[model samples]
Target: MKNLLTILLLTFCVSVSAQTTRKYSNEFMNIGVDAAALGMSNAVTAFSHDVNSGYWNPAGLVHIEDKQLALMHSSYFANIANYDYAAFAMPIDNNSAIGISLIRFAVDDILNTTQLIDDDGNINYDRISLFSTADYGVTFSYARKLPFEGLNYGINAKVIRRVIGDFANSWGFGLDAAIQFETRNEWKFGIMARDITTTFNSWAIDEEEFATVQDAVEGQNQELPETTELTIPKLQFGIAKKFIYRYDFSILTEVDLNIRFEENNDLISTSIASITPSFGFEVGYIDMIYLRGGVGNFQNELQLDNSEKVSFQPSIGIGFKYNCIQVDYAFTDIGDQSVALYSNVFSLKIDFSCFR
Candidate 1:
């Protein structure tokens, strides 16, 4: 009992200082909406009241008063990352809602190899295997209205997992939360906390760096002479605002932030620990459809060298809602290739009302 708490404290401190997201991005980057579209504004706006709220801002669910279901999928030409997601939500009361969401990230066709030491001072390479990662998880979300009439809040906790290959896999837990406020139905604001947990599964670790033949499998590191437990962080935040025009149109501007607490140089985040700030905007017509765009991760300016610095992930998307059914599509492009490396996503939702 004492030892577990100690390990958690260490992981939290390390994960909070100058945390780098590159290593973890590949494993779960596409967990949200249309990859191509999300890629455009630096993947901001997780605190959105749309089909993607399942992966973005779980608190956004409270705004959806009717029963709803949505699904999204993306295709990447580079094949570096690919995935699909589906979700459903239902309002339990005026101030509360419940939902379930699923996610899958797949990395296909990887080369596998084995390293061996030759007779003397040489080395031999053996082709051992090839595999990719198929990670999936189910999330349960609950949203409610705060005591304040204009305030709404939500919470989501998920059991996540990553299967590298048939030989090894790791599982952990994650959480997301959000709060939103409105005034006169013309101006709205939002705040959210993302990925507040560093998850772990049964895995192994070695004290001395040496060739290993004894693979005891699950949590092998637990029995080693001495091993340090691994953990991410418990912090991430975002802020946003929405505007409505007299012409019956609206616009939304948002900034999203994630902080990796890299308090110390550890195996998880030394090579790449930095803060990412993203920007996004959306224009809507009659509250039924919208034209959206966003640019993210910019410390100074936007330039032509988008490929190298990601001046900003620029995206354009459209959305439609009728009779409580809403659908949205966003195109994410970064000048990555001829096809533009875009993500295509669509979602279907249903809404119902009671005590009217």
Candidate 2:
């Protein structure tokens, strides 16, 4: 049975990865949940070593010698949205580990008002209702170290669910694959295949109660004939090196390249135009306090004339560790924004082995 399940998973992943068609759905997957990674502009693909690695690069989970759990919460889009993430990783043996993670992104209590004829000619605002939209994902991940000392492979199987008020909903399933290589020195490299098997979200709508839902999009000049959205494959590459300055101080720098494959688009120009390269570095002092900063999502600025763009998204974070408890804080701007939509993430992690 175990062999059969493994074969089935591999087969499905291979089939989806081979698909060339493109679809952009469930964009919430791109949001960074790890405070440490977000602070460093999401450039931790090669050096991710915490429980949050279950989402970034599962291969990094093998680096956890003790059972660890991490929790994170953040507000996005100026507090209009709520996002929460949690992950727990358990080392199965010297060569294998497993993890589980969950993420929920939500916008709550939206006023649902409609334009309908009342008995009188006047508009009716008294009947307005409230609703909410939310996106959720649950993932199971596993990693194993290869025979070689520094080589590791990992995979994640996830299920996605999205709900719009109680009118419409969607369900999706996808897979991710990752590999990490660490040199004897302080250098590391990583490759992550997101949606390796293109993720397909199948949406359902109640035509009877929500017949106007389709018409609403049509009013905006969009077609709503299709109920399925296929997420194309995205590949990320990363490299990092750590420099030891003094006995108690060290610096780590990393960069990541993001590439997305489309079915019928210009592979080169589109890749170049759409890609958001990330660069970040971290400074550690005495192995207890750390400072991290990085820049990313510059594709728009890079393509436009310099005079047109004013602010580029940047992020900064600080971390403190004592024994088995670690706390991290990150401040970032999703884009050019005032105080209204500032993005801040906080994470707390604890290692269970400390108690054992």
lDDT of 1 at 290: 75
Taken over the whole model, the C-alpha lDDT of each candidate is 0.57, 0.77
**Clash totals for all candidate models:** 18, 1
TM-score of 2: 0.83
lDDT of 1: 0.57
List, residue by residue over 249-280, the lDDT tens digit for candidate 2: 98999999877664322213363333557899
Q: Clashes in model 2: which pairs?
A: 78-341
Which candidate should be chosen as best, given TM-score against the real structure? 2
Q: Mind giving the per-residue lDDT tens digits that candidate 1 earns over 162-235?
A: 55444344555767677776676445566656655544433333223211212212132322222122345434
